[model samples]
Target: MHHDSLHALLVKEKLSLTRPRRIIFDLLLHKDPQSMQVLISRAANKVDRATIYRTIELFERLGIVHRLNIGWKYKIELSDLFVGHHHHFHCNQCGATHTLQANPMLETMIDTVAAKENFSPRSHQLEIHGLCGQCAGQPA
Candidate 1:
């Protein structure tokens, strides 16, 4: 989404457009989903860890960001509200993440299961963990 839209969203949510919050949001705007530690490091001491952590938590709570548990750590990214729903392929060996757009087959499977169990699904995330091409070619 555009920066102006993001600013508008903050206003719509009644969230103050603070420098720390804007800085972190801007970073996420440029980069893909990032871990808390990576976000902190990129801030380069311009923002404090506690503030970044707090802002992240607030963003998640406000549906401005989506948090993914990639087994080892939590990664934060823009939510479907802004970017649309998607999935990821995480390379377990090198800690790389590749975004995957919505798949019809996967969606059908989820819908079938939900119907079978009489469950109303709200949202879903799929993270496929395996070796990337380079890692797969390397001998153990």
Candidate 2:
């Protein structure tokens, strides 16, 4: 989606259309999922670390994006295109993150396990870390 559209949506959601916020949101929306470190490095300006973290926190709370607990920090990406629950796969070697379509069977299994253990499952985040296809084929 265009940055303009994203900005409009944020405005509609009663969020301030600040330059740093817009830039961060647009970058995450257009590019693949990335960790906080990578995003900071690639950002056009030397945005303060606190600023980026706070922006991400606001965006996540507003349902504009979702965070996947993976790697050293976390991976974040646009949440509009994603629906329902699903698993995420993060490559340790390449630091690439991708979403796996939600599996009803897996969801059911998790539910059953929770019930059996008498644990209240609020939510779950799963990641299979390994070398992706490209990285696995290349000489290590």
RMSD of each: 1.7, 3.5
C-alpha lDDT score of every prediction, in listed order:
0.84, 0.76
**Clash totals for all models, in order?**
0, 0
What is the RMSD of candidate 2?
3.5
What's the alpha carbon RMSD for model 1? 1.7
Off by over 4 Å in 2: 1-14, 46-50, 80-84
Best by lDDT: 1
lDDT of 2 by residue, 1-140 (tens): 35666677678888778878877876786566788888888774657778998988887877778887775577788774434466777777877776787788998888889989999887776677877888889957
On a 0 to 100 scale, what is the lDDT of residue 1 in model 1?
A: 40
lDDT of 2 at 74: 70
Off by over 4 Å in 1: none
Q: Which 10 residues in a row give candidate 2 its minimum summed lDDT?
A: 80-89
Residue 121, model 1: lDDT of 82
TM-scores for every predicted model: 0.89, 0.70
